[model samples]
Target: MTEQDPQIVYVVDDDAAMRDSIAELVDSVGMRAETYPSAQAFLDVCKPRHPCCLVLDVRMPGMSGLTLLERLQTQGAPIPVILLTSHGDVPMAVDSMKGGAFDFVQKPYREQALLDCIQAALSLDRDRQNQRETGHRLDQCVSTLTSRERDVFDQMLAGSTSKEIARALDISPRTAEVHRRNVLRKFKVHSTKALIALFAPAPAATQRAS
Candidate 1:
């Protein structure tokens, strides 16, 4: 198995002791962590990166954790965030979940439970990173297709047979078959089903007019 980069866990809280304790707990589990005294502090230093998640205190002196979460969402940043809350803050934390927080841990939390939440957040980040890389690769593959091949691929995806594709593109049926084979080869998919699975989001309008 390839070794993954260490997961970075950001701890943003107003209480210095809470930050220290959370950072220590995270470090004990072999993950990297950084402590921020306030949400603004986290925002000032946060350069978004993959395989990372945030542990944010719900109540902070400046820019509450929930506000920070809202900012992150507005910016379209993909980092997973786990909220930390006191007993009285459970209602707010529940609202944060509805707003896209991965999970929340109540204060006086079980160390094991927090660690499990961190692991889950890290897994989400990894899965998202993998999906982005796959999409980039697929885009590169599509870029390699010739115009005629793209036409054939799109027509095939739109449920057109080889003969229909030929009629649509004003090409011979054999030529349409050749283009179809090239499309499959370029995409590294053996069948139309596999091709569609990979590129289903591609627009149907890409098919040539008959």
Candidate 2:
């Protein structure tokens, strides 16, 4: 399914009634809900990875809510989190915000407030996916440069000596200098690191000097 498909709002709370209530609340509004008793359980089967949000309780037995958030952040899990904490755990909510969680709501929150936060989280996740797609596309475009230019680019990114590159390519050092400049100009990067970093996750170099 596309990113615009119904998002899986994984609500993980050790409290069975609370989890069921949340699932019902979201389902009432025609959204998908997946309930998990623990953080590890959610991580196991949360898939078809489009857009997703997590509503995690603050105090779970195995892994606390904030601990789950940290794990997700470290793993680069793209799903935004809206943590749920008890009144005494408000400090944990603040920490969650600092760790890139979309929002955290204290329990007994109004139903509409939770809904609004979920909407915002889904929108933000969609935006992040779009940016990643655009960046990947730009990286692909960089792969279309000529073979000589590609060599120059890789070397420049590695901070290679222009003289060394010229010797390797059997081209004049002055000529290699021109290629180095061309690589920078093509990628619109002032430095070799920028050029290489751009293509790091993209398509393999085209190497087509045609």
lDDT of 2: 0.78
Candidate 1 yields a Cα-based lDDT of 0.84
Candidate lDDT scores, in order, read 0.84, 0.78
What residue runs in model 2 are displaced by over 4 Å at the alpha carbon?
Answer: 1-3, 147-210
TM-scores, all models, native as reference:
0.87, 0.67
Which prediction has the highest lDDT against the true structure? 1
State the lDDT of candidate 2 residue by residue for 1-210, as single tens digits. 255577778899999999999999999988899899987787777663657788899889988888888888898776787889788888767766777677778788789988988877777766667668778767775686788888777677777878988988889999998998887887678877776676665443121110
lDDT of residue 154 for candidate 1: 86
Error of 1 at 189 (Å): 2.5
For model 2 the local lDDT of residue 199 reads: 60
